[model samples]
Target chain A: MMKRGSGFALSIMLLSALTLSACSNGEGAADGGGKKQTINFVHWRGEDTETFNSIISKFEQENPSINVDMTVFSSGDPYNNGLQAMLLSGEGADVFVSTPGSLFSTLLKSNAFEDLSGTPLLNSFSPDLIKSGQSDGKQYAIPYQLVYNVPVYNKTMLDKLGIQPPKDWDGFLAMCQKLKDEGITPILYGYDVSPGQLINTLVMNLMPEDDSFNKFQTGEVKATDPWFAEALTRFKELVDKGYILKNASGTKYEGALSLFAQQKGAILASGSYSMATIAKQNPAIELGLLAPITTSGSDAKYEGVHTTTFMLAVNAKSKHKEAAVQFAEFLAKPDIAAEYANATGQLLTVKDVKYDSKELIIQSEWMSKKTVFQPRLINTNKKIETALNESLNMIVGGASVEKTISTTQAEIDRNLTK
Target chain B: MKTRNGTLWLFIIPGLILYSFFFIIPAVSSLLLSLTNWDGMTYQFDWVGLKHYGDLARDPVFGKALGNNVKFSLTVIIFQFGLSLFFAILVMKNTKLNVVYRTIFFFPTVVSSVSIGFIWMFVYDPNIGSLNLLLNSLGLESLARSWLGEPSLAIYSIAFVQFWGHTGQVMIIFIAGLQSIPKDLYEVANIEGASRWNAFRYVTWPLLAPSATIVLAYTTIQSFKSFDLIIAMTDGGPNYASEILSTFMYHQAFTYFSFGYATAAAVVLMLIIMVVTYFQFRLLKADRVVY
Candidate 1:
């Protein structure tokens, strides 16, 4: 009985080893035979995975020798965390998608991305948008889309209420008041995620000519500068007047978008990305884009345009660099850019890529005219952004605005020293 | 005897290799990393010994997170242990219905915490959520507020979900302990004219001490290491009100790229759980009550 048991155990062990070897051999065969070179592409566009897959298929069709293996992560911090780990371990994707911001800047500084300078693909994009993806005059990323952060008004509601889109801050306030009097929620703002966006737009509109924000970056000016304080005061006035939603603090980004789509609110202060979602939800709802309303009594117009929406970059340490570069080059073609814009509701930055979406057309008009490419806080220190976002929320929660600003400024100064 | 010892070592080596590779090595490396100023993205890092700890000391948000973690741990232990113990006692008898009841009670534990968090988020959502809708339907409209948005209530709301998710495991453990107690102990007590209260106090309580310790230790560790549910439900927000140590560590490591600081936070959490678990074992250690 003991010998039979031992024989059974031996057979099992031999079987297990054989199975493991077979599996490894199968993997080796798949990787190292007459197959196409596989280049992994990771991106954080969970919503646009279908669009990305379609693009990948087209790219593969054009370049038959290269296969693109795509992985999609949910956007925001989860994607950032996963990408950081992958890069540190030298197992990062051959090609990855990133926005041209502080995270990208940090990765670029660390030499995580391949220098794509002198590539013919770089010449296709507008010079300014290309410059946005560069660090120290070396191109590290290529832009995929142009996004504009401006207030989107419900044109159907506005026409029904006989309120034209406002051109100035006073007119904006008057319109909000009229909406409130008509028992309509004036604005749908999700302060839970980053209250700073709303405050930043206000500051940009109020202090367009003032370069004092740059002073705060250099420690030459405090966050409690009168311009910033005045902006906060105006925001507070809006909150006190109930022009902003009552439960704005509790509402999430998607929740606010849903509310806007349901016509519960007359206006949504969001980026161009929200247009596709809102349109998908309520196709009949007419949407109109407005430039940032001027806070000064003068008639000054400014549009907060974002140049780098989604950018593709090659990993410097990738084993399949040639294949990755080929895929990236293919993505930069004007036809592919137009197809990408059609698939995903983002505007292309390539010179000759003509796409027709009403929202994109309006955003393009603003881009052609008076556009100040918004300085994303993601381009700044994470602590400073966190401090600004939290302090803005606290101010909205009835904390002393002056104290919040000074304290946040102090925090920023401390982070700078670190 | 020598051959037997060699065979035992052969059996143990693979497990030891895995443990060393997966746990001990990572833990030691994390301790070393905690003393540096690595931003995670950059290859270069400076040895800033205890500086992260100093920064953590000065960070009020870290303090708030630690406090939130402690509150969460305590709340989960109370609800999870109390309700689980009560249910375990209820179903300790080997009745046909008891199997069904136990299965029903343990169902939530089998589901992923992320799914539970998402399910609870929908229930807590202010506008179309069932919690608020139910309240409004019953003419309790004033009580219908955003449950996860409120700072004071958010931590408890997450703790309640944690409690709901894990109470079943605790119940199962307690049921095993209850089943192991011989029937004659209770019968002898009944023959001696002892009441159900007296029988339970003298016999069942002391016998269940070991199981209680196991449940407490497991639940405490789980509470301290809680991340996914909070991340999925709150993302530590409505302005950092529901932020816990794990979420804060994650933000520092990934969001802020402060890997060294995040590792320090992880070390502190590890030390806290170890100390708490040690004391728990000491206080609950009971002599064997063999029948």
Candidate 2:
């Protein structure tokens, strides 16, 4: 009886082990006998699915021996959690996308990215734009896209109404009133997630010094400072004047984009990354860049905001490291970068890439003017960023500016202590 | 006799090993991880020894999230429990119409929570939403407001969805319990001239104790796990007013990369659920009930 029971137990244990091993076997390409090496590429830009596939096809045509399998996860928790889960399990992609700032810093600290500083493609990208993917003087990733971090207004509507983009805060207010007079929602503001976007455009011009926000991170500058207060007051002013729609705080990204695309609103308070998407939603809509000008035209130090994001990095643990690096180099080529830029209606960080898309050509005019890098990205701690954004949102929610500032300062102080 | 005992031990060993591998190991590891400052990225992390818990004790967001969780869970339990019990009693006859009603009610439970959240978000949208349009058309424009956007109403709004989705499921359980109660008890109550309410208060209430106990515990757990619905709807936004423990922990780990802090929050959640469930069993004492 004892032997019979022990034999049954042994069979169960073997079955369990077999099941566990089977579940773990299919992650990375461990089959060594395959003739072609396949490298997995993952990114969060589902919108760029077609453009990336086209690029991959060209890359595959050039490197016939190597195959690139691309996967696109939607932005936010799905992509972040999916990638992190893969990394935690030690089966991450060969080449992946990284956002600049906190996410890049976290991955860099964890040594998830390979050192790409030695790659010859480094010289092809603009030095200032490439610095976004660097940490402690070591280049780990290559930032590919240069996006204007300002509103994309309907150029056709603005021109039909004989309204040019505003030159200052007063002009901005006047434009809002004029648009409202015509039964248009002045700004399609989605207070849910775009509070940070709006705050970045406003505070970039409000900074007394270029590194003012960086100082805010190190506790050298308090959130209760006058400039921060002014930024909050400006947000509240937009709310008080009814420039944005009522119950705007409840509107999310899709609803806001839909309203603007349908021409229910005159201006979408979103970045240039959304320009292509807006055009797709309404092909007849002519788009233009509208950076919020806080000072008089001559006194304004910065005409717009820009950020170099969608940094590409090779996974450090990838077996096909050479192929991954080759893919990165291929993307950096000037002609190839221009192809991406024209196809996606995005600006490229590659030094000599040219734009042909009408929307891109018109918005590229802001590239000649002084544009500050998104100051909000200067602080790498997401907690602090969340606090600042919450303060701005609270101000719009009818909370007093002083109270919002106090709570923001307290959060800042607490985070700094950690 | 000795060989029989040894054979029994041999049979139990395999199941014990499997349980330890899956459940016991991860639970203990999470407990240990809560004491460190691990950021969920790298292998290298320093042992902070309760520093995360210390920070959470003073964190105002954590306090608000705890209060929101309690309010959310209680509202779901009270409303969901009452509604399910009422429907279960009404549908106890097991006719064809009643079975169709049961199936119709259970349909939402099978639907994905994320889908439900999206559908409800459109319904609650401030502008161009069906709810506001309905209210306006009915000449109740004053009652039209952003349901999911208001801080005071967001948690409860999501709670209403939670209960609405699962009440059908809970009602099925209660119906089974009602059917199992002996009809002779009701007959005796009628023969003794007891009112319907009195019969329920004495016979049905005590007899339904076992199912009620299970339903109460299940509802509590379900309400505490409202992470997906809350995330899909408000994402604990508009100044963290609707933030609950699960969403709060998720944001800390995934958003803030503070896995250690998040694990501490998880540990607290587990402890709360355990204690609450234990007290529920104690209060009901349904284990002692026998037909």
Candidate 3:
């Protein structure tokens, strides 16, 4: 009887240990004070690590009872996969950042983020900027940064070469020709995310509707449409003119940025978010924002493309939801947002935040100008987005516009659910 | 005896439970999940029942990726095996210089795949790459081209990297096999006035067949597992010219969020590996000799 009882006790002990191990979130441990808690935060913005750490330090100072532990993944698929695995297993994070569109949709479908619609944090952001993080009329995340998703040009180079920023399609072509004639590559392009950004900048003034990417999903519009084909043709023309680098499609993001910083190219076909990095690479580079004018007329609808991305959200399964919310609310505060904007060279969605960075100050004037949302991020289906992005790469690699459009349209057609 | 049995079970119980929960259960779940129209994150999904398999059959990118994998595996296996064996034989003698050479060759295998990928990407970079730069310096400027950017050359370029990275590691296996061959066999061949080629063909080659089998199977799997290197270098691009089955499945599952489709592709990959390995063992089993 004694032996049997001891065995039973051992079994119970083993089960208890297993349960204890499973219950721990690994990092979010509470100390003696019941109010004290740690919140795990994860994001993909490794470049903003220092700035975010400063912000978190400030938040922790104000709320001494809460500690924020942050984890950053290298941007792109690595972050997506890491976050998805964690959220699926209900471990590792309490607060996280998300991008708009397909990733946001995935997070929402998983019921991963707590709805921020009724929260006071929602009131602090611009309503127009907040809409990108919304789905089915529910605000699941708060977009923190407002960025012009267009090419950032070297103002110093253009000034020295006596070139003006083009306002129309023909002017843009002429500008490229002139840059090429002056023994300069007109554009520096990267292989990874530049193709999508280039296509987005090109189609912003040309796309018939603001939500045409979604319209493609519904079969209301198609990739084979004349607008998209024109975008491809224009992209191809730049390649044919030898204005794009001979090995543009082979260049990585950092390589292109470095080349552009060295004055190898007049324009870097990445967005305004890259301003800080470009400055870091070459502080002497005088930067200006240029959106490709696809239309010939001065009555072009949008001056550039803008997106409210780098969305922040409280994880739904967070044990310290109040602390997570508190930290988010701290970020929404005007002074803090202003500090973030100035330090990171980013424009924030927070109302009445002051900009101090020279680049931010210059680009801030374009905020009031007519700017469309990043059309690429409007699609809920990522497969369609990937196909469209690949279409741009295909055109860059010398594929015919007809084949590119048909292939993309077929992908869109097959992916349509509605 | 009873006490020994009880102790044995005590050791086995923990590992059995872990194996069941971690490997066996997840693998079975993955197999089942392949039948459903699951989007990975969403909880609710309908049973689709082999529809993903049918879709994969008709998918051109999947076909292209499979073809690339085949081409990649064949190229890596042939070149990696032949070169490793040749180097192994040359350095098989237990001399100080040979040891140094062996260590030098095996050094790359110890480095992480990501670092190797990054290093090779720089080497293959069209403008600033060492290859093109070297060609230009040698007055061969016309021969210099985008090594990774060209679709026709991308997969072969990646395959060469795989071969370069693993040849030394595989060479170690052949070296071990060479050392195991009885010195008397070579003496007998020499006494019979056997030519160098004839001795190697009869003695070293036959004795090395088992190691060759291991090298072949390992290189095959390593080629398939070149997902990280490919992702870092070309990301299965210029177009899908460099994509293999593993990268294709990763894009489908993680990038496109099509868990069901990706799982189906994974199942196909598993079956392919199993059948190929089976054939490898069978083909080699005939030549394997026991002392």
Candidate 4:
């Protein structure tokens, strides 16, 4: 009874403290002209929150009438829960980050954004980027950054080995074989299983022949497609050949990246964004970007990706609708995009934009000249992604590709049906 | 009297409203959501009652996650409780500099979990981890491997971490429980010619039951909902060896937008927690423990 009483008392005290903090902050913000209007800006870039806040500072300067209250969810938890909870309560973020995933579409249908179809800033964005931001018949979100998935290799290692860059599947395998013979692990990948594992990079590389996502997304492809099976086989082969880091199934992204930076590994299955990070961490780390390896023989196709390009959406229930639009417009500006790219290691969709980010410059140049755009289709289910990631991790770690692929196909089919 | 009761009810109304809005409503709606095929964010979710649950039965990942969660919970219940009790007893022993020791021990508990997770990752670093590096410098090279990267060792490494991160909280609870126990019991046990183990087994153990119950509940929930540690440590990877239900749910819903499917997973996890807690509460018949 005493313990219970003490526990209750502690809770009450903590509650009071939280309430006090809330009231004081709320009061300080609200002490302005009549009833002050605050825009709740929600995002998941805490590692870059300072940069985000600087952007917010610019927004506030541009619109002196409004104060921006920010909500930052660490990229790990990613704020989706809090967002979902608030959204369901009809009181979510005023200006929020939107993805092409299910939640973004839900927010769109719920009328959680203002119609910005004919806005002045509309002409500033790329036609493809602007189109990617559409839902039904309205433009709700603004494409913020374009990210691509591909293989990155050690330039010094390949050069020292006197091997040309892998242009096709056979060339890639030959490179892998050469690296293996030289006692170097070919691809340093983190395959920790569960859903959404690093399989996306491998899968993208292996399935260049098929626009797998395009087919599955349009309801035009079977879950049991032969290409997916082929992708599975290729992933298993990478594992069987010891091309992947020996303990990749246990390694984390940070671990893998660190190893690659140390020159202990040859190839890293990473996105274009990583070039800048690699350079930042190790400036002298001679790196080269390659097209995601698909089909090793005569069928090799070096496809590019336009997926993971994030956008900002005005919350449907935002009170400061005009200000939110202003925020999106600001983020889309080439100059602002350049700054954001420098800060977040990404690129603006406008190819010609000279980003302050050297990483963005290198990646964008590589992308424009070669890679294919694999936009993450809006119709894809996250469970399917998870299943694919898990299945790929399993395959790479010596699990049966056939069973895992079939199971993944079944899950994808089931989720799509739902 | 009626006015006082009315005032109390009025005060409680806000709390009730908040509770229903934040907790009860979501819990109820989640049940409704589990019956549908909501992509989690899109407005177009079709009701597919029990379909997801049926599919979940065939999900190998679900089975793996479930088994892993149970194993984690059971380990946490044992090691965490055992370590906490040991520390609590040691601290409860009359000694000088107890405060300093207590503060030092609990230092980790007060720090943000993210910090601990990151620091521990460094400690377990295969090449540069201070732990392995120290061992190697001391000519113990064979003992070190990629602690976080090896599938066979990742889950245990992570579980041990959580055990370390949480031992202080559990210890404090145990300390509180031990202090609250009357010293007269020890004296009475001595007069009865009981050995220290016997006295501990009969007297101290029974009195610690309440603390045990609370500790078990906390660890059970924590282990079942293990995410931050796993995300920080292994992210259920190398090959999903360390994945628990929370990571699985987050990946399913947020990463892919399978809200209804994720909800089904969440519902299953919740049921498991409730059942385990219930069974434990019944097992202890906790009412038998006298203050």
lDDT digits (tens) for residues A1-418 of candidate 4? 5698899999999999988875533333444454445667787766677787888798778766667778877553367766766566554477787666555565666566677788886777777765667767778777667766666778888899898886666777888999999888888875532124234444555553435664564456654667667767776777788888875655666777888888888877776667777887788767776653656535544455555446677777665677667777777777776777787777766534666655666666764554445423444454454555667666655678777767667666765633
Q: What is the TM-score of chain A alone in each candidate?
A: 0.89, 0.90, 0.92, 0.84
Instruction: Please report, as a value between 0 and 1, the fraction of native contacts recovered by candidate 3.
Output: 0.58
Task: Please give, for residues B1-291, the per-residue lDDT of candidate 4 as tens digits.
Answer: 999999999999999999999999999999999999886554667889998899789877788888778777777778998998898888886567776777777888888777888899889866557988888999988887778766677777888888888888888888988998999999999999999999989998888888888888888888888788887776676556777899888877866557898999999998988998898777666544755
Q: Between 2 and 4, whose TM-score is larger?
A: 2
**What's the C-alpha lDDT at position B210 in model 3?**
91
What is candidate 2's DockQ?
0.64
Residue ranges of candidate 1 with Cα displaced over 4 Å: A1-35, A192-196, A207-218, A291-294, A297-301, B1-14, B286-291
Q: What is candidate 1's lDDT per residue for B188-278, written digit by digit as tens?
A: 9999999999998889988988898889999999999999999988888766778999999998888888899999999999999999999
Q: Per-prediction TM-score, please?
A: 0.92, 0.94, 0.94, 0.81
Candidate chain B TM-scores, in order: 0.93, 0.97, 0.93, 0.92
Candidate number achieving the greatest DockQ relative to the actual structure: 2
**lDDT sort, best first:** 3, 2, 1, 4
Evaluated at residue B2, the lDDT of candidate 2 is 100
Question: Residues A1-418, candidate 3, lDDT per residue (tens digit)?
Answer: 5699899999999999887775564433345444567788898888778988999999988887788889998777788888878787776778899889889888888899898778888889989888988888998899999988899999999999888898898999999999998898898888776887888888887788898877877888887788888888888888888878778767777778888988999999899998998888889989999988988766588888988988999999888888899998999999999988898899999999999888898779888888989999998788788888888778777778888888888777777754
